[model samples]
Target: MTEKNYLTQKFEADRSRLRGVAYRMLGSLPEAEDAVQEAWLRLSRADTSGVDNLSAWLTTVTSRVCLDMLRSKKSRREDALLEGGPEPSVSGEDAIERETILADSVGLALLVVLQSLNPAERIAFVLHDLFDMPFEQIAPIVDRTPDAARQLASRARRRVRGGDVLDTAQTAQKSVVDAFLLASRTGDMAGLMAVLDPSVTVRVDAFAGGGQSRELQGADTVANFYNGLAQTARTALVDGAIGAVVAPLGKLYVVLDIRIENGKVVEITAVGDPDRLASAEVSVV
Candidate 1:
């Protein structure tokens, strides 16, 4: 086979693995495809005669594309920026089915926890822990020394494993989270208030669809926001803290990262960002 044909054949062979890496790095399907396509584009245009491993080269390129996309997602005007591209030929239902399978395969709770991490930390952790790449290879991709990259992965590992050993304090916190979720699901205003500090706060990230990040202070305001809302929310552990995951029809909609102090919930952060969610390690309570 000619070099051109040979390259095309090899790329097709590596596509699935590359897509998996991109998807883990970017929780959104469309974004992951875009990252992979960008990698293919680079491979097609660049010289690879001296490259030792085509798969490794492609992974690095895809990772850099994903990292850039993750960093830019915050400043983008809308999710529609991704939607503006040529629509995939697949039918809508087929697309949904594929997404559902992918989400299940990757685990929504894990995605939610990954979303809580910073971009560098998420990349380091995913590459090192999930993909089995070494820190030496990850260091340049994240613009850090090998040791620094190791530190980043180490920190991410701790956060991923943070909720594993729940001590007395965590147990009590879980009770508080359970109470809050039950009350919210049942629409029990009084019960919800009982578990919330008078000075409780709720912060919703912009990805939750208000066009901006929102904050609600005081028990009354926070309780009102959650009232009649968590009907579909289920109890879960988010980064070792008692929290809730709102996954309707098996697709993760939101993650409520809760914090409790002195037996009452003091803070709640609701996140819907896909990339951030991809980094989190969540589990059923």
Candidate 2:
């Protein structure tokens, strides 16, 4: 076979792995697929005589594409700023299962924290921490000095560590999610109130420039907001647990995996966005 045919075969063989890397970096399957495709096209058009490692070369190309998309998305989110309430629901169990399988490395909480990072930091962290790539190689992909890449990884690590509500706190959060779901689905306001902590705070992502996006302080307010939501939306079970999808709201769908503490709901997070939900699963339960 010709060099071109050999390269084509190699590309096909490596596409799936490359796409997984891209998805973890970007937190969007469609974007990841696009990035991999773009990388393949670039490979096809470039002179390959000097290319020593095809897999590494493709990974570099895909990483750069995903970084570009991340930057573009950040710009768009900043420009089109909307009143973020809750994430909209796309589908049910089958949809989530498909997304989880294709993503390969993403989890709900990780995806949320990823949104806070710049493209370079995100790429560096994913490469060094997730894929176990050496800093020597990651440096060039992110166009930074090896020391700088290390710092980027350090900063990303700090952010993740700080935002982690998992670890020892997961059981508490899971209990809250379970009780909240049971109460909401059954219209048991008393049961819901019984589980909520008096100091509970609900903050919706309003996409606002500064300040708490949508903050509801005190258990009463948080309870009331959820009670209202439960009354309006249709509830169903996904992956053997209760979930709800509400239309006409930005956070149209939310899934809760409760964390129980000394018997009260200390934290109740909204799991609606596919990426966020995926990441949350990693950090939480």
Candidate 1, residue 154: Cα displacement in angstroms equals: 1.7
lDDT of 2 by residue, 1-285 (tens): 976678778887887788778877877655666677677667777898898998988888888888888877831122221232112222567545556665323544455455557789989988889888888999988889999999999888766545333444544444555567667767677877898888876545432213344666677777777773553233322232333333212122344433345777655444455564434312212
Give the number of the best model, judged by TM-score: 1
lDDT of 1 by residue, 20-95 (tens): 7877777866667777777767777789999999999998998988899889873122223222222233347876
- TM agreement with the true structure for every prediction: 0.62, 0.59
lDDT of each: 0.78, 0.62
